[model samples]
Target: MKIKSFEIFDYESAVTFWKSIEGVTLNESDTKGSISSFLFRNPGLSFVAKDNNEIVGTILCGHNGRAAQIYHLAVSNSHRGQGLGKELVDLSLSKLVEANIPRCNIFVYSNNCVGNKFWLKNGWDDPTTWKVLQKQLDV
Candidate 1:
């Protein structure tokens, strides 16, 4: 398996891989055009893992001026136990560090047991004092 930067050409395979995973949620922001714009805004932070040229894992990472956010981290079921997820995360975090981002955040659904477990086990702290609130704006 080889890990590499995520190019727009990798979108289809990455989306397919993400759709096959249980805990990942896809939304309007996930469209190819949106992703392309995201890549443009924050280059070299997102990545994919491939096995024999087939995309097996992905992580979409970006940052606002203040903090980094990670999204859509998924690995094929067959590739789950091999540390691909952690590797993807580490790569993104390293990029953030280089960019001088002070903190990183990821959103996992409260009900996504596997995802929550993975994050916790990987030393990500879940702070009880904060709640994520959102409002969908009509674009």
Candidate 2:
């Protein structure tokens, strides 16, 4: 298994991996193209983990050169419990550090027990630094 940054070639594999989630309600499959386009226009900021030529996990890292946001972490079902998710996170941070990014953050839904536990176990804590505000956009 090898963990590597995102490539234009990995888009289809990434989509397949994402589409397998049966429990979560994500946007329909139509967004795959937009997602790939976003990453293609902004490289070195996201990653895809593959094993035996299949995408097993993915991570999206946002950038400002000072801090980065880790989001959209997804690991294929069969690949769970193999540390691929953690490896994806580590690789993103490693790349950010190499580029001189000083801080990073990831926002997981508070109700997601496993995600909360994972972040806690990984030493993610910065309550005062994050704020949640929203506006109702007229539809």
Candidate 3:
């Protein structure tokens, strides 16, 4: 398998991959156009892992010019034990570091047991003192 930076052409395959994952949440905000816009705004911070040109894993990394965040990190069921997730994280974080980003954060759904476990196992701390409250806004 090969790991590389995400490209526009990989968008459909990445979306398909995410849809197959058990805990991934997809909504109107994840449309092709929105994803394309995100890629345009945060070049080089996202990645995909491929096996013979088929997308197998993906990670979307970005920042708000203050803090870095990682989203949609998933590995195909067939490729989970081989460290693709770690590689994706390392590569994206390297890019952030190059851009002088001080820290990176990831959010896992409360009901996504495997995902939560994966993050904790990979050294991501979950602070009990903090809550991830969000307010949906209209555009």
Candidate 4:
């Protein structure tokens, strides 16, 4: 499999891959329009792993000026253990470094044991000093 920068045209395959991943969350905010906007804003930070024209893995990354954030890091069931996830993350981190972003973070659901384990195994430390909070806003 080859890792490549994500393109707007990969949306369908990416969405299908995300749907197949057990821990991936596809919310109302993750529509095609939202994804297009996100890609427009954070070009070259996200990536996809493709094998024989099929998207086998994906990682969405972007920075918020001060800190970088990773979203929807996933690998196909048949493609796990191949280090694709780490490769994608490393690529994103390199991009962040080039942009002078100081740090990076990813949100993992408490129930996503697999994701949590992957993050920890990849040397990501969880900060116990802070809590994550969010509120829905009406637009």
Model 4 Cα lDDT, one tens digit per residue, 1-139: 7899988899989999999998999986688888888888999999999999999999999888999899999999899998988999999999999999999999999899999999999999989999899988775
Give the distance in Å from residue 35's predicted Cα in candidate 2 to where it truly belongs. 2.9
What are the lDDT figures for the candidates, one per model?
0.93, 0.73, 0.90, 0.92
lDDT of 1 by residue, 29-105 (tens): 99999999999999999999999999888999999978999999888889988889999999999999999999999
Please tell me which model should have the higher lDDT, number 1 or number 3: 1
Native-vs-model 4 lDDT? Answer: 0.92
How many steric overlaps are in each model, in order? 0, 0, 0, 0
| Decreasing lDDT order of the candidates | 1, 4, 3, 2
Where does candidate 1 stray beyond 4 Å? Answer: none
| lDDT tens per residue, model 2, 32-78 | 67566667655787888778988777887767667788766888778
Tens digits of per-residue lDDT, candidate 3, 1-80, equal 89888888898888889999988888776888888888898999999999998888999999888899998999999999
Assess the local accuracy of residue 80 in candidate 1 as a C-alpha lDDT between 0 and 100.
85
Instruction: Give TM per candidate.
Output: 0.97, 0.76, 0.94, 0.97
Residue runs of model 3 more than 4 Å from their true location after superposition: none
lDDT (C-alpha) at residue 95 in model 2: 78
The CA lDDT at 44 in model 2 is: 83
Write down the TM-score for model 3.
0.94
Clashing residue pairs in candidate 2 (N, C-alpha, C atoms within 3 angstroms): none
Error of 2 at 37 (Å): 5.1
Worst-scoring 10-residue span by lDDT in model 2: 21-30
